[model samples]
Target: MSNPLGGLARRASFIDSVRQEGCGVCIVDAGDFIAREGRISDKNSIQLRIAAEFMLQAMDRLGYAAANVGEGDLVFGDSFLAGIAEGLDVQLVSASVFAGGARPFAPARMFTTAGITIGIAGIAWEGFTPYVAEHSDPGRPMAMAATADAMREGLEEIAGADVKVLLAHAPLSELRILLADIPGYDIAIAGHDTNMEPFAEPELAGATRLVNRGWDGTHAGRLDLTFDRTGALIAVAGSAVLLDAAWPDHPDMLTLHADYLARVAAALRDILAEYPVSPPPTGTRYAGVQSCVTCHPVQWGSWRQTTHALAWQTLVERSRDYDPECFACHTNGFQWTGGFTLYEDTPAMAAVQCESCHGAGADHCDAPLLPYSRPGEAACLRCHVPLHSPEFDYGTYLPKVAHPKAP
Candidate 1:
């Protein structure tokens, strides 16, 4: 499985379920368990660092076999990963990401369970090349070799194991190509690329079985393999477990989750308190939504009934009101000139107010006849892009909030 992104609520339960089967369990992550963009603060921010610590602690408790050192995991830099790796029970492996022509983490790890020696090798996507050049120390960019070379090297390292699995954090298409060229692996888990839907069943390419369980921690992939005494391939069953609301939260992980949530909330509150939000200058052109409600009563009422009116409240409910990544979409004129900054400063601008769509209402409220650009799909796209609202369709959504001109 891949792309857990700090979600720990349902993971432990899934792991426990596998263990309950009374069979040997080898839990491995393809890549991208840690979130790259940082959770409550900027990259490598203290808040993010704290969150990462909690996440790895949960992983340790769950007893992960091995996890590939993905690009997202490296976002906090090599030192942060090294610190986590030093204490982890799980082995972190990567054949591609290197410094000074040497692999920084384990290229492969061997696990013996139920009379089977399973060898798992990890290869991160080489896409981190440009990132290394910019964020790394001067004259010391991480060396990323060609994909073929990395896979060949990794395969050779793990060739002797009874059962070989390739934890590939590379493109799905490229992994398929490698499967053809390197037929030594018995199982391959793909990651890093988009897999909105999981495979219907485990696919056999050459002698390897390929599987990928989409991005995000919403779903997990499972493969149950039955091998003969000779280590000959026999039977394989694969399916995706949807970690929805029905799945009970792991008891221990739930406590950890709540603790981190509280920690992040406190950190955000402290930050906001130190730098309270304030309103724009009086001379600015952004008159608050109240300034427009007087004349545009119908439009104002219509907006109040829409989700936009409660955008800020949603964040408050989730304790993310001050979150920079979230606040912009929920509040009016975020980061724009003369726009909302912190809640203390721009209380009137809270929620996706009129200015969020119709541009600043200061001039319009003063002169109703003045030119105001009518918003279109582009305006909605600013927040409704794929990540948050993948199903968003312009024509289908516009009429839901459309307010016809007053007769």
Candidate 2:
């Protein structure tokens, strides 16, 4: 799992280096900082809420100027989001999003840095208006206005700014229409387009220069704007800097991460205790790796040498062993009936095992020729998704994990 802490650490270092150059800097996020909907089921809402809270606290610590509110941030409802935002220094903005016929956050904010008065505004996609209404608290119904109309209103409020920037939480097609309709923005930072490759160079959308730094915290987009003596914007340049091992982890963020792990672990433990793993239907239970080793020693030995065997160790090293989201992929049969639950109770199901791919093997073990499932591309995709394995190619990867058939 790629924890945000590593990227945040690199960002901290990168920001300090930029400050050393004697240039004024401002930090902002495009939004969708929270986890996706699938990760926050009723069973694990408490754990994810703790994570969301930590994310906000960390953003405040980093001194973020502002962040847009994307759809993913609404999974917990507007009242929950508002309560958290009230305690943070980072301003949450969205011109399109409204609660009970009123805007939940300021449409725009002004920041004067390096003799430049910059006005930044945020707007969500109108297409997701229904989603906003569905997820909002019943007491405070949320609504979204037309994207272009919202952008126009937000930009109008900041018309006097020397430079106008927009944080647009919509797809590229919609963004083009918005820029075309509302023409004053100097720069637009795109969000909610998960498929977009990080823009190494800004794309011209009418008079506005649009940029996106892909999804996840793997990269940070840097846009350097040059203005003439009269403060007229003259040039714009952008690059996506990958947050990798080259940068050391920031001490402050590391402390925060440690606290997060401890708190999340404690919460998960309580949740698990309250709701014990239910029994799987008769004859469908998992028969751990030990059961397989007795029947096919060669395949079992080969599997031990593969990365899947050590998946659990990876999480342990990063102190993320307790996170249910990470736990699901790293361990076998997590959240599934008669599968992995707590490590102490289910040590045998600690890592990806034969049953994880072939389905629960208790029935298969009872009768050798009972027609066991042979996992195909779809099975691998369940765990090797884009976010976790962006470079995964089914053809290239299958061969690496292939084991000889039983004699």
Candidate 3:
């Protein structure tokens, strides 16, 4: 996963550079600031909650002016959100989100910087109600008003401001229609389109300039606004900066990250204890690397020379050996029957061993003729997905680990 701490550091550096150039900066998030939109599960709930808390704290430290309320933020319910918001320096705004027929956050917020007032209004898509219904707490049910109605009301509320911006947690098509119909917003920052990639140029929805930084904190959208002597908006330029390894990690964010990791590790240890590993049934049990070395010495030696043998060591070096997500791919038969559980508890299954590719060898060892699984494209693809192994090619990668059968 991409580290948010690194992204925050880069953002802080960018902000400092802009301010040093004698330009005023107003930082705001379009939406989805709490967590990613998905079902909450026992395995991930702890990590997600901790991550959300860290994100809020980091935003406060960065001095964010405002952030939109996306549907994902409702996963923890209104009470949890309210508790967190109470301690935040960032203003959370949404024109549509309501509970008990009343809006939970401000309809819009105004920020004055360098003698110009900027009005920002937040709006969530009406279609996100289904997501909220499925994942959100049933006790504190929320409703989304009509998008057009919300936009009109929000625009009317911020009419007196010099520049009007819409922070919308909706798709581009929806924003286009609303911006065209509303006809007032000078700029619109659209979120919720996960598939869209960040672009340098902004799209026009009527007269409003539309921009989206995409998801996952991989990039930050930048807009340079130029106003005339009368403070009337004259020109707008937009671009996106990639948050990569080039930027050094900010000291403060690094400290926050370490604290988050330590807390998550403790929570994971408890979760693992609650759900202890259950051994697989007879005939399909995983046989460790040592069990196969005697029978197929050549294959065992070949495997030891490959990167798969040292996968667990890589996680250990990075202090992620205990992380279930990272361990699943790095170790042998993770979460499977008789597979890896805790690192210290199951040291034999530490790395991708012979059984990781071939089927569990208990039956194979007992009866040599019994069919055993051979490594194939399907087997490799399970771990070599685009997110983790983007350059993986079945044809080219297969040869690197090819081993001869017994003569």
Candidate 4:
């Protein structure tokens, strides 16, 4: 709830640079403005309206326009986001999502800063299809395939508006396909998928430029495209930089952080009072993945990517799926040593328990997170290029079986 006290320092330097380089400016956010951080809570939609208020204030002073909601936008549910969106001047662009007949959210402004027109838009991962369906009958679905079509259609419609920018909150895989077709998509921004790639990790997937800013606002990316009055791509300048110790601080951003901290303190006090924590209660369910690894390193280290570690997230993102068999394998919470005595019950989510398959957590848990357990046929069948478990055998596939030691 508390923001970094050093936020002011970060914002100050960034702002000073912008002030001197005044020009067309546009700012975009990759959704997730709200959330149940780390899958721990039922609902934790932290006053997105407040976050918006602070962000817009910074934008106004810095000079810019527009931002879109990411899937995390639904953390508090639709009605909540809609309520918070009021009073903000930035665009809440997402074509696939709608409020009745009107657009999901958007603004008339195309942010121009330092001679750049950032055509910003927001889209969610197609995987969210299940939740959105139950929430709003917008009749507009963002299927991976359908989204590609939407992007093409949107380009034709928005392109003529004299705006030459596009932003999306789709997954990396989906973005890859969208980028494959160029001219239709000039500059694309993405959320949902985290990427450490430099600016616009673009593939001339045909013609468009593609990039993802990763997550948690640790870094910001920019794409500056120069187009003729007719909207033909002339040139582009893009950069992605880390918001580390080196980045200059922003005084206003810091002030905003302090205000957020004060409010968080008051709200948290009330929450604690209402849901007072009991001393070591039982029968409780938690994401629990982070806690176990701390004590059981050797076994846990290898399981970081084990199928189980990946299981909870998959279910979190896709619980609506009708895969009963899979539903049982996945869990909201779990206990390892106890075993799945009750298929319908919560399962200990020790994050893949590389130990479970690897046999024991006696070793390897202490070292690195990379390829913790030596890869083997068993691990492979648990995940990637998975096959029937019966077909896999340890004698055949050794651990650390990188590059498919054998077929």
Top candidate on TM-score is 2
Q: Write the per-residue lDDT of candidate 1 for residues 1-407, one digit (tens) a residue.
A: 22112246776888788898889888888887776422223422656666667867887889888888777776666667778768679888887877656667878899877777888988866666766445444444575667777777778888888888888887788778778887788889888775446672778767788988576666778888898877866877898886654566788987886787677666765544343334433324677788877888998889888888888998888666756657778898765655676788788888988788778767667778877767888889988865456568899988877775743
Model 1 quality (TM-score): 0.81
C-alpha RMSD in Å of predicted model 1 compared with the true structure: 4.7
Which ten contiguous residues of candidate 1 have the minimum total lDDT? 36-45
Instruction: Compare candidates 1 and 2 on lDDT and give the better one.
Output: 2
TM-score of each: 0.81, 0.91, 0.86, 0.57
User: Candidate 4 lDDT (Cα, whole model)?
Assistant: 0.49
- The candidate that wins on lDDT is 2
Tell me the whole-model lDDT of each prediction, alpha carbons only. Answer: 0.73, 0.81, 0.79, 0.49
Candidate 2 weakest lDDT stretch, 10 residues:
1-10
lDDT of 4 by residue, 242-350 (tens): 4556765565666665675456444543332333233211222232434445655554465554445675566445332222223324542122233322223435531
Instruction: Please write out the lDDT profile of model 2 over residues 380-401, one tens digit for every residue.
Output: 9988876567668899998887
Q: Candidate 2: what lDDT?
A: 0.81
By TM-score, rank the candidates, best first. 2, 3, 1, 4
Q: List residue ranges in candidate 4 displaced over 4 A.
A: 1-12, 36-40, 43-64, 99-102, 107-118, 133-145, 161-163, 181-183, 195-198, 226-232, 273-407
